[model samples]
Target: MKNVYITRIAKFLPNEPVENEEMEEKLGIINGKASKARRIILRNNQIKTRYYALDKEGNVTHNNAQLVAKAVEGLCDDTFNKSEIELLSCGTSSPDQILPSHAAMVHGFLKSGNLEVNSPSGACCAGMNALKYGYMAVKSDQVKNAVCTGSERTSSWMKSDIFEDEVAHLEAVEQQPILAFNKEFLRWMLSDGAGAVLLESEPNGKTPLKIEWMEGYSYAFELETCMYAGGEKLEDGNLKPWSEYPADVWGKMSLFAMKQDVKLLSENILKKGVASMKLAMEKHNITEDDIEYYLPHISSYYFKENLYKEIENQGLHMPWEKWFLNLQKVGNVGAGSIYLMLEELINSGKLKKGDRIFLQVPESARFAYSYAYLTVV
Candidate 1:
C-alpha cells in the first residue's frame, strides 16, 4: 500500500488577545449581579488568554473564511501547489455562512478548480474529519494530494447583552439556566484561530510529517448532547443566546463516546497494527519506554485532569508536563489543537524519525471520535 503523508502544516490566530481578567471585569460591569459568579467561573477555568476579533465598538467579529484563507496561503507558500491539486476539505463548526460549506470558500480563495472540495461541519471534529477523508482519498489512489483546513471564529456569535443577562440570572439563582445560555460559561475559553495541512501520497520529496493509518468511531448516544447553529438573530444584527447545558446534563456523553471509540480502535486498528503500549511491550518488539510522546484532543481543564487519572488507572505512561503546559498557552484550538501540538513536537526536536505518535480526536455528536496513528519519518 502506498504511504499517505502529511506534507505541510500551518496555523493562524487573531491578533487581539482577550485575557480572562479583562473578560471578567467587562462582564462584571455589564451585569453587576453576576460579577462574583463570573469571576469564580473564570478563575476556576484557568484560561489565561483567548483570541477574539473585535470591532471599534468592541463587538465580536466573525472572519472564519478569512483566517482559513490565510492558513491555506501559508501552506501553499511553504509547499508547491500544482494546478491539479486533487482535493480540498475544510473542517469547521463556525463557518462564515450556513450555505456554501467553508471548503467552497477556501477553494475559491485558492483559485483551484481541478479538485473536489468537501466542506465538513462536524463541529469540533471537522478538521480531523477532513484529514481522515484526505487520507482515504490518497490511500485509495483516488487523489495524489489534498489539503485539510480547520478554522473557527466563535466570537462572532457572542451576544454581550444576552450573555450578561444570562450571567446575571444564573448568579441570582445560583444555578446555570440551561444549555442555551451556557455560551457565557464558555465564552472566556473560546478564541478565533485557523490551521491547515497539506497531504500527499508519500514523502518522496520535502515534507514535514508522514501518516501511517487513521481510525474513527461515533457514539449515537451523544447525538443530542451538543449542537451549534446561527442561533436567533436579533434586530441589532447579533447572535442570540447559545446553548451549552445538554452536554452537562448528559454528563456521561463524552465518556460514552470515548469508550465506543476506544473499543472500536483497540479491536480494529491497534490490535492489528501494534499491541497495547501498556502491556507486553517487549513481546511486540516495542515497549512503553519506546514511545516518546502521546497527543490527544484538549477538551477542557477538568476533562484533561480526569483523563490523566484514567490513564494512571489503566497504567498507561503519562505524557510530559510540557504537553499540558502547552495547552495552558493556547487553550484548546478545537481540531487544530492536536495537529498544532504535533507540529510543535516536530519543530522543537522532541520527535525524531521512527518515533511513534498517537493522536485521538473526539468531537461532539455533530462529528465523532477520529484517531490517527502516525510515525515520525
Candidate 2:
C-alpha cells in the first residue's frame, strides 16, 4: 500500500465567537425561561467561547454544507479549485438534510463537477471515519489525493424554536412544564464549525504528519446506544425510530433531539476505550515513552482527569504536558473535533520531525472509538 500523509489542513468556524455569558442571548431561552441545567453543564464543560452559525434572532448565517465548502475552499490557494479534487469524503453527526447526503450537498455548493464522493455518518468519531476513508483511498493508489471533512451546524437544531413544540408537548402528555434534560442538554453543549484536510501519497510540507496506522472498534452488541438522535430509546433499550412514530408527535416529543444515556456514558466511556487502546498499542509496539503528544476529542473537561487516569492505569502514561486539547476554547464540534485539534497542533509550531502524535476519538453514539498514530516527518 502507498503511504498517506496529510498535505493541507483548514477549518471554518462560523460567525464570531459567542462568549459563555452571551450564550443565552444568542441561543435564546426556551419557553421564555432560563435553563436550569445551563450553568451546571457549562461549568463542567468549561467552554469559554463557541461559534454559532445563527444570529441573536436565530437567523442562519451558514448551513452545514456551506461550512464544509468554506473549509475545503481554504485547502489550496486561489489557483486551486474543487474540480481537481480526486475524492470528496465528508462526515457529520448532523447533516443539513437526510436525503441528498452531506458530501453531495457539499459538492453542489462547490460546483466541483464529477468526482468520487463519500459520506460517513456518526457522532464524534465521524470526522476520524472520514479521514480514514481519505487515508485508505490514497494509500491504496485509488486516488492521488482526497479531500475529507468533518463538520457540524448543530446551532440549527439547538435553537430554542426547535424545542418549543416539544416543550408544549411535554405539558400536554406528562404535565412536564419544560423540555426534559435529555432533550435540552445538548443545546448548551454543541457548537458549529467544520474542518478539512488534503491527503496525498506523499507529504507536502517539510513537517507533514504521516498517517502510520488507524484503528477502530464497535461495541454495539455489548452495549446499548449511549447517545442517539432521530429516535427515542424504548423501555427495552431499543430505539423506536422517528419513522415508526406518528408525524405529529415528532415535533412534540422532540424525537430528533440528540441525547445520551448519562448512566451508560459515565460507566463505560473511559473503561471500554482504554482496554482497546492498550491492546492496540501493544499490537503496534507503541509505548508510553514513544508518545510525545495525545489529542483526545473530549466533549467536556469533565472527562479530562478520568481519561488520563484510565489510560495511565493501562500503562500509556501521557502527562498533562503531552496532552493537547482545544475543547476549552472550541466547545464540542462533534465530528469536526479531531480535525480542528490537528489543525491547531500543526500550526502551533512546536512539532518536529519523528515526533509521535496519538489521537483518541470516542463516540458515545454506541460505544465506539477510533485511534490513529501520526509521525511528524
Candidate 3:
C-alpha cells in the first residue's frame, strides 16, 4: 500500500513557562482552601510547567492566528517549497474567529496559494481528523503534499475576569463552600502551543515517520452537551440568542466560555477510549509486541491510572516505561496535544529506525477517538 510519510514536524510554544505557583498567585488563590484544591488537582495531574500566550502580568500576549502562524512558519524551511503544498488542514478547539475559517486565516497569513484548505472545526480530537484528511489526500493522489496544523491559545480563555468573580458568587450561594469554574483549576490545566506536520506521498530524505494506518471513531454525541463552548443550547437543541440567554446561561457566554461535566467525562472516557483502541488494534492485527512506543493524548492526570488499567483489561500489558506523556510540560493543549506530543518524541532522538509507535487520542466533545500506527523511518 502507498504510505503517507511525515516529512517534517515543527512545534512552537508561545512564551516562557508558567509554573503552578505563579498561576496561583495570578488567580488570587495563593494560600487557602481554594489553593489546597488547586494543589491537589495539579499534583494528581502531574503537570509541572506549561507555556501560555501570556505576559508576566497574565495578560494574553498573542492571538490564536499569531501562534498558529509561528508553527506553520517553523514547518517551512528553505528546502520546503510552500508552492508544492497542495493542501492545508487546520484544526483548533479555539479559533480566532467564527467568520473566516481558521484554515483560511492561516492560508492568508502564510500566503500559501489557492490549494484546497480544510478546517476540521470542533473539539481537540479534530486535530487527528485534520491530519488524517491530509494523509488520505496525499495517499489517494489528490495532492502531492499537505500541511496539517493543530494550534490552540487556551490561555486566551483565561484572560476573562468574569470567572474569578463568578466562582466567588457560586461558592457564596451554595449551602457549602464549593469551587466552580475556579481559575486555579483551569490555570494549571490548559496551555498554548501550535504544532504542524508536512506530509508527502514519497519520502523526501527528511521523512522521520511513516503513518501505516490511522482510524477514528465517534460515539456519545447524545451527550454532546456535556462539554461545549461559545454558545448555549435551548431545550429543543437550538442555540439561544445572546439577548435571550438566562442569567445562568449568560454567565457562561464568553468567547471561551466552556461548560463541562467533569464527572461525565471521567465516567465514560475509559470505556469509549478502550473500545476505540481495541477496534483499531484488531483491524490492524496489532498487539503489545508490535508496538514500541505508546503515545496517548489524555486530558488529565486523574485519568492516567484508570486508562492503563482499562488497556490492561484488554490483555495488552504495555508498561508505563513505554508510554510517552508530555502533559506534564505542556498541559492538555486541546487540538494541539497530539502533534505537540509527537513532536517532542521526534525531537528527543530516541526513536530508532523501524520502531513501531501507536498513538491514541480521545476528544471530549462528548467523546470522539482517533488511533494511528506509525513507524520510525
Candidate 4:
C-alpha cells in the first residue's frame, strides 16, 4: 500500500484572545436569567479564551478565504514553489460564497491558477473530510503535494438577530424554541481560527506523520434536522425554510440561520463517536493499548468525561492521561480544530519517533464521525 505523510502544519488565529467575560459583555448577557444561563454555559464548556477574526472594534477582520490562505502560507517553506501544490482541499462551516467554492477562493488568494481544489463542506466534519481527500490523493500517487485547510469565521454568524427575534415573538417565554434559548450559548462557545496541513507523497527530510488509516461515518441523515441552518422543522411538523420567516430573517439568516436540539445532540454524539472509534481501531488492526496519544476534536469540556465513560462502556479503554485538549484555549473551531490540535502536539515536542496517535473527529450538524491513526516518523 502506498503511503501519504503530513509533512507540514500551520495555523492562523486573528486578533487578540477574547475571554468569556468580554464575550458575555459584547453579547449583553449581563444581569437576570440571561446572566445565570451564560455562566452555566461558559463554566460547563470550560472555554476560557478564544480568538476571533475581529478588528479593534470587534468587527469581522477577515473572511474565510483570507483566513485559509494565511494558514496555508504559514505551512509553506520560504523557498517552496507554490505551483508544486497539485491540490487544494478546503473545509469550513461557513464560506465566503456559495458559487466559487471555498477551495477556489483560496487558490485565488495564493495567485495559483488552475491547481485542483475541492470543497468538501460537511459542516463540522468538513475539515477532516478535506484532509481525507488530500491524503487519498497523495496515497494514490495522483498528487505529489496537496494542501488541506479548515477555517471558520463563526463570529460573522454570532451577531444574527434571528434567534433574538424568535424570543421576542414567543407566545410565552417558556415556549421559545431551542434555537432561541441556545443562541447566545453558542455565541460564547465559538471563536475563529484557521489550520492547514501539507500532505506529500514522500517525505523529504521534514518531520512527517505517516498516515496509517482513516475512516468516516454518517448515521441517519434524518437526524440532520437535529442541527442545521437555513431551515427548521417547527413543533407543528411543518418545514420552514428561512424564506418562510419574516423579511428580516431572509438575508443573513439564510447564511447563518442555525438551530439545534441540544438534548438529542448530547444523547447521540457520544454513542456515534465511540462507534466510529471502534471501527477505526478495527480497520487499523490496533487496540487501545497501541495508541500513545489520544486527540479528540470535541465540542466542549462538558462532554469530555462523557466521552471517556462511553469509551469504557464500549468495552474498550484508552490512556486517558495521554489525551490532549485545547478547547479551553481555542473553543470549538469547527473543522480547523483537528489540525490545530495536531499542530500543538507536534510543537510540544513530547512524542517519541514511533508513537501512535489516535485522532477522533465528530461533527454535530450531520451526526458524523471520522477517525485517523497516525504514526510519528
lDDT score at residue 151, model 4, on the 0-100 scale: 84
TM-scores for the candidates: 0.74, 0.97, 0.88, 0.90
Which pairs of residues have clashing backbones in candidate 3? none
Give candidate 2 misplaced runs (Cα > 4 Å). none
Winner on TM-score (2 vs 3): 2
Write one digit per residue (lDDT tens) for candidate 3, span 1-377: 36799988988898788787877544444214444566787888888888888787766778887777788788876887676688989999889888699888888877877799999988887788899999899898888888998888877565446454455555567733344442335656788889999998776644368899999888865554446765654566444445565656455334246656566677788888898888899898988889999999987888889999998886767788889999988888889999999998988878889899998988876688888899988
Q: In TM-score terms, which candidate is top? A: 2
Range of the 10 consecutive residues with the lowest summed lDDT in candidate 3:
175-184
Which lDDT value does model 4 have at 143?
83
The regions of model 3 sitting more than 4 angstroms off are: 25-36, 164-185, 221-224, 232-249, 252-256
Quantify all predictions' global Cα lDDT against the true fold: 0.59, 0.89, 0.78, 0.79
lDDT (Cα, 0-100) at 335 in candidate 1: 57
**lDDT, residue 152, candidate 1:** 73
Query: Among all windows of ten consecutive residues in candidate 1, which has the lowest summed lDDT?
Result: 252-261
Compared with the true structure, what per-residue lDDT tens digits does model 4 show for residues 1-377?
Answer: 46899988999998888887777444332212345556778888898998878765556689888999999888767656676688999999888876789999889999865689999986778999999999999998888888998889877677544345554445245563333544456776777899999988676534689988889998855564566666766786345776667776454233255556687788899998898788878876799778899999988899999989999999889767879888898888988999899999988988778998988988877688988889988
C-alpha positional error of residue 341 in candidate 3 after TM-score superposition, expressed in Å? 1.2
Our model 1 lands, by Cα RMSD against the true structure, at 8.4
Clashing pairs in 4: none
